[model samples]
Target: MKAARSDRGSQTRKLLLFTAERLFAEYGVEGVSNRQVSEAAGQSNNFAVGYHVGSKEDLVVAIVRRHAESIERRSAEMVARLPAVPALRDWVSCLVRPAVEHLASLGVPSWYARFIAQAMTHPTYRKLVFDEAFASRSFRHCHEGMFRLVPQLPEEVRRERDDMGRLMLVHMCAERERALQEGTASPRSTWESTATGLVDALVGLWLAPVTGPR
Candidate 1:
């Protein structure tokens, strides 16, 4: 009986969190309300949000965490498919390919990444979601994966590449918002945005061959 009750509770929490995520994504963070979340999740009680989710910020953070975990899991799975001794080119795609393919298939807007940046740097609510929703272990695993892939780059170089990856992610996210407003949808948001291609460009830029975009 206890096990059954626990499973039921877990299912309920999952339902609530999933509903909250969809609502927040469709409606901007400021526009969605907790009661609406509860209603959207199909719960009968208006007080369900207060009882189940602690705060509006908590709800937003929970949504962000969910997306983060999904992305990380996809990333790990994709990385696991790479060659045992990955080159810098392989390493770069391993870090980025999963995100582009997976999110694209799910019809997810890169706006979520923008949402994450805004959440992470928000004066009022920064770190609320990042610390709580994402497991520290996931970030650790990602760092390890990158280290394995970029075995040749000095630590400083790797860090610079990582920063570049972040810039690309942020750029993708910001551009997505514009694309949505402009209704310019495409399989590839921008030309030459492939993870593998991006890695090649970055590697060349870092090495000074000057073969591609900086």
Candidate 2:
């Protein structure tokens, strides 16, 4: 009886999370609250807080874990396709391309990456940096590769290089959202062009010789 009840409860929580995930992706994470999530999720009572997944923060953490793991898996496959001895540019591109491609998926909610990036600066949710990839090797792999490719880059510059991929994702999301707005914005469904532009910008950032004066 207990195990069956536990399983059913877990299922309900997961459904609520999935609902919250899509909502967060569509509407800004900050714009949505627990009541809204519960109401939107069609759950009864305060089941989302400390009952199943702790607080909304924990739910956000859960959402990040799911998406980041998918990204990591996709990145691993792309990395496997690289040359035997991949260069810095190759590694960095591998790190970013999966995210760019995945964002193009219908599964991802609107402005998801932008909201994730914004979480980087948010005091309450900044731990997402670690969850996103800071402590992970796939991320560290690219960081080390940058040093190998551009050996002269200082520590500060190297740090910037490490985060460049996420930055690109954020910029792409923001640009696309802006382009999607009415009146002032143009109807640029030209995503291929925008993605190409993002790749070019990334390569330029990494390949630019960083040895000159600060």
Which candidate gets the maximum lDDT versus the true structure? 2
Backbone clashes, candidate 2: 1
Write the residue-wise lDDT of candidate 2 on 57-155 in tens digits.
Answer: 887887777667766777778777889888766866765666666666633235556556656666677676465554455766765765577657778
* Residue lDDT tens for model 1, 98-187: 555555554534345545555555555555754643344544555565566443665666677666766665556546644754688734
Scored against the true structure, residue 175 in model 2 reaches a CA lDDT of 60
Off by over 4 Å in 2: 1-11, 22-31, 107-111, 161-165, 177-195, 209-214
The C-alpha local distance difference test score for the whole of candidate 2 amounts to 0.66
- Residue-level error in angstroms, candidate 2, position 158: 2.8
| Residue range with the least summed lDDT across 10 consecutive positions in model 1 | 205-214
In candidate 1, position 115 carries an lDDT of: 56
Q: After best superposition, candidate 2 residue 156: deviation in angstroms?
A: 2.6
Pairs that clash in candidate 2? 50-54
Compared to the true structure, candidate 2 yields what TM-score?
0.75
Q: Which whole-number lDDT from 0 to 100 does residue 131 have in model 1?
A: 68
Error of 2 at 212 (Å): 7.2
